[model samples]
Target: MGGAPERADGCGARVRGRSAGSGRLSVTARTRGWRDRAAAELAAAALATREETVGDVLVVGDRTGVLARALGDRGAAVHRWGRRLGEGEVVSAWPPDGTVVLSAVRLPRSRAELAFAVHAAAARTRPGGTIAVYGANDEGIRSADRALAAVAENVTTLRVGGHCRVVAGRRSEAHADGGPDVFAIDFELSADDWGSQRLRGCGGRYRTWPGVFGGAGLDAGTRALVRVMAGFDRSPERVLDFGCGWGPLARAARALWPDARVEALDVDALAVRAVAANAPGVEARLGDRVEGAACYDLIVANPPYHDGKEEDTRVIEALFSDGAGALREGGCMVLVVQRRLPVPRLAAARFRRARPLADEGIYRVWELVGPL
Candidate 1:
């Protein structure tokens, strides 16, 4: 209806064809189910009219397996950025002009995440272009509507259906500041301060404010893993900090093995940025997987086990699988987790060997490795 037309695919599902310019469209989704629902809705809208022209479509956020499955019915170029997109993270650079940008994001629980969502929504929409956001009732959909209205030129709650509400807005001017408190802050980490830093179990203190992992204090799982890590031969030339939160493990690893080059990867862009700020010397990248062919001698992670508000293990599985593939022969993946999680079972199937290295009463360090 917005000048875009939908065309029918051979699979009988309606798919939107490309539009003018780059003909690229962007859909930011929350979970796998939501992604499927949104894609179906968009596909239906696109096929009924067959007028919307889109060359490429990019879906950003978690449970991309669902996004891939939903897009499977359509014959179009599709790419995905996996779980937990941070502030200002855009899956594609497709301009908002004459584009259909759909966001199925949950309400932000923290002020930092809220600011990030606002900025992300604004960046995806062009002047006078429409952006749609859908969320469940309890996720503060109403509050989200209010917040969007305050920032955008025209905002409206388009629909509320299936226990979910859709809010649409258009930005005619620059985004009003989400307020100074939510703005990014500068973080400095130094050896001088490291001596006093108290990050989880690391006796040396590290400075990290809110929004960073283990920001409030150290989690029990990380503290347990750090203690057991000392028992392993720590002299590896290459190491990977999968799901490195706030650079605590990176900081500890770097201190123990000064000669090793450590690579930190996290799904949260904000976390990645924060880690970089706190550990300038440590190589950190924002992404879902371990990038590059250089296998690490050691891979450590406390992979995320939650999605939005529910307990989900998809992200953790992805990291564990990737870590196994990214480790060199005889290299080890040291992971810490609550004993209740079936991580050992998951690891046993994925790794050549998996066993508990140490149990700290609450958490256990699961070590998986190639033929030891």
Candidate 2:
């Protein structure tokens, strides 16, 4: 009663009262059907609890749409990044510099990703505007305060609940010019590592944005897949690199079959952009499924097994199903997966003929012919 007032709505939700002077909702109560276990819910609650009023808010990496909806309901002008926005909503790669008053980030898994998100948010936020970074404590939210300090000042914890916490700070004018290029990394795959002198000749230099898989370096699994591809006796006319992270596979495919029309498809926007930047002329598409069934003469993939922090095979399995549908008659699909995964079993269930192409100890490459 001494602090901001509280009230219960007709629906039995205990909504936190707004400050009379600020006109900002102090906190949002958990509504029926809202899950406390979700990090998104905790982030929304934390934003509501902040003392500052939310105005012209930008929510980043909100895959679930929870934060955007909550802030909008509280009368904040909400813009979004990371996922597709609703129809009639403003959609851009990022908001214009110094236009946003507040930014809420759903902390990414990797530190490099965290740095990129924070820097971008700081760039978009007006001087002295707020940036709130939130995530589950188990997912490294504790280090968020330090991450924010790179581009912000007066950093402090805003709220803690549901095994999650939100840390916020005021964006510093000194770091307002930060952009994606601040975290972009350039590296090259050595000829020996790729096992192809031709691919090396095609230019090994590649660039990757933070948070893209295999951005730090080309992973061993992908390298193994590339070596196996180099051994193929026949050339493919139309190749699709499914789940092409940073377009390494697409790049290799292009080099091996110079005349082939190579395309890269990934679900991540950053990954798509990376493909465009790193592998010029390779068609990069952003989506989960392959378009135009039976159009591809070859489909190559090192499918993702993990969904966030958890190891989920369903992602690769779905890719297998989609790739199979996209392959033409006599076309082949090649995949590289960790040895611990049951790729043989999974591939057998989806393809008429699945055989081991290579066994590189920790990683295995499989070549499947005839889509069943």
Candidate 3:
């Protein structure tokens, strides 16, 4: 919308920390276009003046994350929520109310994600403070508006410069229609039946949550990883499920090697929570990369290549190097990824030997050994 909002001349990338690959650096991309449009449209609104937005503008669920800097440039003390790629600070909890909360939707999200953002925004906004939501017309704005009516008073809509609509409402009640509470985070999930398959666990269903990768169901590549992994022998002393969404691989490792230490790591808080809550004995941690001196005998992952809607290989690129560092000498790493990725080249840089172990349609699994 609005000719794809112009990129800020000084806008650039920022690295939050790092991910799995030992040699790779995972940096957040500077996403422009629709994000800038939403920000610009908000600024142009009568109520979104410097006096209203400055020193207290809070943007949530915005993946592009361009608004924070844009507001900062305008002298507003800005606070942002949600993950930008894999980079973000651990916000112990939601900021208090009495501040303007601007929740904009980016990157297609499940209904659970949208509901959480909306209710979270409402709960964090003081009664009488503003809560503005922006979204593309086709991005379920109408459904959101219907839901917003429950928490806000005198709701109204305005068409913005982009093919977007800004729905402004004042926070009155924290609960929306008494339908669900504000902090309804789906911490425990039963993987949905996508197509014909289910990522079932020995206890029946694997646990997952909203906002986690493959939370809804297993993707094609993960399916391949599970299929290939099932065939491997179960004797590893310790295993790390790198970038584990909800500990599928970690669960698998645990099931196969009942005594092995199965650890799962992910950047998403939701995923971390699910793994901790429903994954039972599996160890779970946050952030994109690994820490600690414990070396893994085997590392399994279905690494993410996209940051939000944009294709970002930096994490994957970094994983090759970082993952190698997490393993002990003679240890091995098993991974599944899209065939187009230069896995062999990246793997060769870290592993002593890297080769494809299986192929399923567009996905490939590689078996790589830690250097001697």
Query: Please, what is the whole-model Cα lDDT of each candidate in the order they appear?
Result: 0.54, 0.71, 0.59
lDDT tens digits, residue span 55-133, model 2: 7788776655677788888877776665211211222234444477888888877888888888877877878989989
Task: Give the winner by TM-score.
Answer: 2
- True-structure lDDT of candidate 1: 0.54
Give me the runs in candidate 2 sitting further than 4 Å from their true place. Answer: 1-37, 49-54, 83-98
Q: Residues 184-207, candidate 1: write the lDDT tens digits.
A: 554444443333233323443344
Root mean square deviation (Cα) for candidate 3: 7.8
Error of 3 at 190 (Å): 11
Instruction: Give the TM-score comparing model 1 with the true structure, all chains together.
Output: 0.65
Residue 114 lDDT in model 2?
A: 87
RMSD of each: 9.2, 10.5, 7.8
Tell me, by lDDT, which candidate is best.
2
Return the TM-score for each candidate structure: 0.65, 0.84, 0.73
lDDT value, residue 155 of candidate 1: 76
Candidate 1 residue runs with Cα over 4 Å from true position: 1-31, 34-111, 123-131, 170-182, 185-217, 230-233, 291-294, 350-352
* Model 3: residues with Cα > 4 Å off, grouped in runs: 1-51, 54-57, 62-66, 69-77, 83-88, 92-108, 135-147, 162-165, 174-201, 291-294
Model 3 lDDT tens row, 34-136? 5435644553453435355654566664444455556666676555555323222222223334445443333235566665656666655657666666666
